[model samples]
Target chain A: MTDYSPLLLSLKVAGISTFFVFIFGVFFAHLFSRKKFFGKSIIESLFMLPLVLPPTVVGFGLLILFGKNGFIGSWLLNWFDFQVVFTWIGAVIASIVVSFPLMYQSAAAAFESLDARMENAARTMGASNWRVFWTISFRLAWPGLLAGLVLSFARGLGEFGATLMLAGYIPGKTDTIPMAIYFAVESGQMEKATFWVVIIVALGFSTIMWLNWWSRRNIERYKNDNA
Target chain B: MLEVQIKKKLPHFLVDINLTVEDEILVLVGPSGSGKTTILNAIAGLDHPDDGRITLNGNIFFCDNEKPLPTQQRNIGYLFQDYALFPHMTVEKNIAYGVKKMNAIEAEKRIERLVNTLGINHLLSKYPHQISGGEKQRVALARALATEPSLLLLDEPLSALDSRTRLECQEELQRLHATWKTPFIIVTHDMQEAEKLGDKIIFLESGLITKTVDNRSGKMIC
Candidate 1:
C-alpha cells in the first residue's frame, strides 16, 4: 500500500508557506513599484536573489541562519525552546523563501502597470492612502496578484533541496512529495517514486492550465467593451 | 474663494503664477508644457510648489510655514483628461466612492441628484469600459462633484469629445457652475472654448502668465 502522508504533508507545507509569501510579496511589491528611495535598486535585487539562486544555495543560507548554532536558531532555542530544523515548520520556511520572489515579481509588475492618474483621482476624491490602496489599487492589480499566487503556490509545492537541508525528510512528518520521491528513487522503490512524480506533474500542469484559461478569459472580458 | 501664489522650477522655465478665483470660472489657456496643468495640480495638492501659498475658502492648503495638507484633506474635485474613472467599478460606485462615509441615505440621494442633473441616470450599473466617451465624461464629472468639494479643477475636460459633444458639455459645465457655485479653475488649449467658459481668462507662455483677460468686459486685466 502506498502511503499518502507525503502528499498530504507537501500540501500542508506548501499551503502555509504560500499564504505568508502572498502577504509579504504583495506588500513589498506595492512598496517597490510606487516609491523611490536611495538604494532602491539594491534592495529590490536582494529581494529577487532567491529566484536566481540555486535551491541548495538558499538552503545553505537558511541553514546557517536557522541552525541551532546560528544567530536566530540559538536565540530561539534558548528563549522559546524551539528548534525549526528537521521539523515540518522548517519545510514551510524553505518553501516560503524559495517561492517569495515569484509572487513579488508578478505583483510588482501588476502594480507598476496601473494608471497613476486613477490613484491620483482617488486621492482628490478624499480617499486616504490606505483607502486608495484597498479600494482602487488592490482591486485593479488583482489579476496580476492572482497570477503571482498560483506561481508561488506551485513553486512551494515543488521545493526540494531547501526542504531537504532544513527539514531533513522524516516519514509522516517532514517527508514532502519531493523528499519522498528522492528517497524512493535512491532506494530502488520505482513504483513509489513514479507515483509521487506523476502527482507533482499533475498538480503543476493543472495550475498552469488554470492560469492560462483565466488570462484568456480576462482578455476576452476586456476586449468585449459592449459587454 | 481660491488664491494661489506659486513658483516652481519646470524643465523649460520657472512657473511663476499669481491668481485668485471667487465663486466663478477661471480659465487657464496655454499651449502644451506651458504649466497650466501644473498650476491646477499644485492647487489640488497633487504637486508641490517651490514657494507658494494656496488657500481655498480661508483654509491654508499649502504654505512655507507648515507641512502641506495631504490631497485627501484638500477637498478639491479634479476631473482628469482621460476621466480616470475606476474601471473595475460600476458608474454608480465610482460616483459614490468619495461620499461613502456619509450616511447611506444621504449619499444615495446626492448621487441620485448628480446623475439626474448630469443626464447619466441610466448609466449607474454600467462599467466604464462599456460606456461611450461622452457618457464617461459625464460619469467622471458626477463622481468629482459627489464629494461637494470646495474647489473644482478641470484639466482639458472637453478636449476628448467630438465637436457636438464638446459644445453640449460646455453648456453643461456652465449650467453646473451656476448651480454648484464652487470656485472652478479650468485648463484648456482652445481659445474659443476659453472665451465661452471663462469668467476670467489667463494666458500662459513659457510658465508665465503673459495675459489675464476679464471675459465679462473683454478687457486685458494684465
Candidate 2:
C-alpha cells in the first residue's frame, strides 16, 4: 500500500493543473468570444480536442512530444533542465490538457450571453479594449467563470489515465492520489485503498457542496439585482 | 452641429436619409422597420451608409466606405430602443459605465446630476431588470447624458413605457431637451410623440424620407 505522502502529491498535482487549466481556458475563451480572425473555428476546435479524445491517447501524444528522449523533451532537458516526463509538473500538464475543454466551454457560454452593446458603450466612454473587458465583461461573466473553475478543478482531482501515462507512479516522488489508489488496489492492499478513497470521497463531496452553495448564492443575487 | 447624408440598403429595408441639425432636436418619425432607427444607427457608426457622408462637429465621422471611425471614437450617444441598459450593471454603474474614465470628481458629479435630473436617484442601486420600463428609460437617458456627448440619439424613449408613465416621461424628455442644448436626434413612430418632443420632424417610409416638419413655432405641445 502507498503511504499518505503520495495522496498529498495527488492533491498538489490537481491544484497545479487546475490553475493552469483555468488560465489557458479563460484566455482562449476570451479570444474566441470577442475577436474575429481567420481560422477562428480551427482554434476553437483544437481547444476542445481534449473533451472528445481518450485521455490515454492524449497522454501518449504528449509522451511522444515531451518524453525524456522524445523530440522536444530531449532538447528542453539539455538546454533548460526542464524535463517534464515522470515529474509532478508532467502530471499537472496532462491534467490541464485533459480538463481544459470543461473550463473553456463554460466560460465561452457566459461570454456569449453578454450584450455586445454594453461593451460598446464602455468603449465609447474612453475605456481601452482591455479595460472594458476586465471591468465590464469579466464582472458580468463572473458566475460562469466560477463554474468553469469548479469543473476544471473537479476534473483535475479525478485525473488518472493521462497522469499514469505521462507521469508514471513513483510513490511520494511523482504519484498522485488516484495513481496511489490504483497501485494500492493492485498490490492487494484493500484497507489502504479504502482509506484513500474515503479521503477523496470526503474531499470531493465537500468541494461539490461548496460549489453548489456558491452557485446558488450567485443565482439568487443575480435574481435580486435583476428584479 | 451634426450633418448627415447617408444612403444604405438592407435586403428588405434601407435608409437613404439626409439631415442637418445644428443645435436642435431633429426627430425621425416612422413605424417599425421604416428605417428611422437605421438613420440613427448610421450616425452612431453602427451601420454603414452605402454612399453618403456624416460629419459631426466638423469631424468627418463617416463617409460612404471611407475611414469608419468605430462607435467608440465618435463622440455620439445612442439610447437603445428597449433601453438596452446593461442588465448586469447597477443603475448607477450603467449611468457611470460610459463616464468612469473622466476625472474622478467630474465622473461623480456628472453621475449625480444625471441621477437627480432623470429622477432616478432612488433607483441607482437597482439594475435594469429590477426597474420598471420608465425607470429603465430614465436610466438610459442618464447613461447617455453622462458622457456629455456632442450629439444624443434617442430611439423611442417613451414608447416602451406604460400609457400613464409615457406622458410623464414625455414631459421629462421635454425638460431634458430644454436643459441640454446639444443636437438631439430622436426616432419614434407615434405622431403625437414626434409633435410633442421633436424640434424638427422627418418622416421615413420604406427607408425614404417622405416628409419634414420644422418646429419653427417652438411651442411646448402634445
**How big is the positional error of residue B206 in model 1, measured in Å on the Cα after superposition?**
2.2
* DockQ per model, Cα: 0.73, 0.45
Given the true complex, what DockQ would model 1 score?
A: 0.73
Question: Residue pairs in steric clash, candidate 2?
Answer: A226-B130, A227-B130, B7-B50
lDDT of 2 by residue, B1-222 (tens): 888888888778767777789788888887798887778878887777888899998899887657888777887778877776777778888787777563989789878887888888999888677878888888888888888889988888787788889999889877887888899888888888888888788888899888777776754332
Q: Which regions of candidate 1 fall more than 4 Å away from where they truly are?
A: A223-227
**Alpha carbon deviation, residue B51, candidate 1 (Å):** 1.3
Q: What TM-score did chain B of candidate 2 earn?
A: 0.93
C-alpha TM-scores of all predictions: 0.97, 0.90
